[model samples]
Target: MPVTWRDLLDIFLVALLLYTLYRLMVGTRALNLVRGVLVYLLVWFIASLLGLSTLSWLLGNAATLGAFALIVVFQPELRAFLERLGRGQRFSSGPLALEELLLGLSRLSEKRRGALIALERRTPLGEYAVSGEILDARLSARLLETLFYPGTPLHDGGAILRGERLFAAGCVFPISESQIGLGTRHRAALGLSEVSDALVIVVSEETGAIRVAEGGRLSPPLSLEALRERLKGVARA
Candidate 1:
């Protein structure tokens, strides 16, 4: 068949779809599974080309089963992707009460109170919020300080911020298993950051250090000014 613009357009669309899917899977656990599947497919192709009949047949059969299994295993990521697509999010540079956020975190750090806060960005932290009490309260330095107050019942759990509001408190976030020798609050901050685009802030009860976790990596103790810049960066992203 003669080449046509339609053929080029079709190929471009497929490439775009694959790229989009890869980007969506990047911050999620499904990325590893995708790599494994790609490796398996490569091996299958090589086997077929090399005339390894038995090996090719076995891999082919396993591939069929794997395709169905992956659908079940990636349910959470799939649902989240669909929901995000439906809602359509864009990073807005609108005003945020960052000073209030900083003031609260600064005081928490000074008091040597452990605190874990996840700020929702393009990704939704709704699932984790459901794990704790819903506050839906106004955002302020006092509110942030009070939530992580040692005497408060919600002190042990993490808090989540949605936009300019304190969406939820006493929220339980996933704990990261990658880093060793980390305190509980730091581990939890890294855990949620690893899975989503959310920026997680942590305060060490022992040392009163302020740290931010993002893209699966933990930052060293940051000064209050540095922390303010990070929050502003997220808002402007």
Candidate 2:
């Protein structure tokens, strides 16, 4: 077949789709699902090439049905992607609120009050919110401190922040069952990072140490100055 403009466009579109799928699978449980899909595709191709019509037809139908199954099974991932796509305008409207969040972290560090703040980015934390109290309050350092303060009922779980709103407090996040030896808090932070792009900050209740989690990796203890710089790096990117 001669190379044509339409062929080039098809190549470009396939490249884009693969790139998106790669990103969607990264650090997510969906990676396993993707592997299963790939294996099924391979089996289907072999069956067709070997003149096994019945097996090929069955596999082909399974592939189609598997796609719909994936959509329902990975509803959270799809919802997060769509939610991020829809928030392009909303982010531009609240640059100041983000600035405030940055400042609030600074204030909390100065006070040495232990806090774990998760700044939701492209990922939806709605699933985790189910484990805690729903607040829907505005995001502020004072409110953050109050929730994490000692003797408070909702002081143990995470505070889930959405945009500039503190949508929920004391929400239980998933803890990794893997033998990474991470403490409960770190495991919870890692669980969220593994599934989403949301940046997680953990302030040690014992030592007030600050750590940031993203891309399934955890940074070493960071100072207020370093934390601000790391956050700025993400915001700019």
lDDT of 2 at 152: 89
TM-score of candidate 1 to 2 decimals: 0.86
Model 2 clashing residue pairs (backbone)? none
Q: How far does residue 54 in candidate 2 sit from its true spot (Å)? A: 15
Output the worst ten-in-a-row residue range by lDDT, candidate 1: 87-96
Candidate 1 per-residue lDDT, tens place, 67-162, comes to 888889666556666654555333232354677888888888888989998888777788899999999887888998888889899999988888
Q: Name the regions of candidate 2 deviating beyond 4 angstroms.
A: 32-114
What lDDT score goes with residue 231 in model 1? 77
State in Å the error of residue 213, model 2: 1.8
User: Highest TM-score among the candidates is held by which one?
Assistant: 1
Query: What TM-score, to 2 decimals, does candidate 2 have?
Result: 0.71
True-vs-predicted CA distance for residue 167, candidate 1, Å: 0.6
Give the per-residue Cα lDDT of candidate 1 at 20: 86
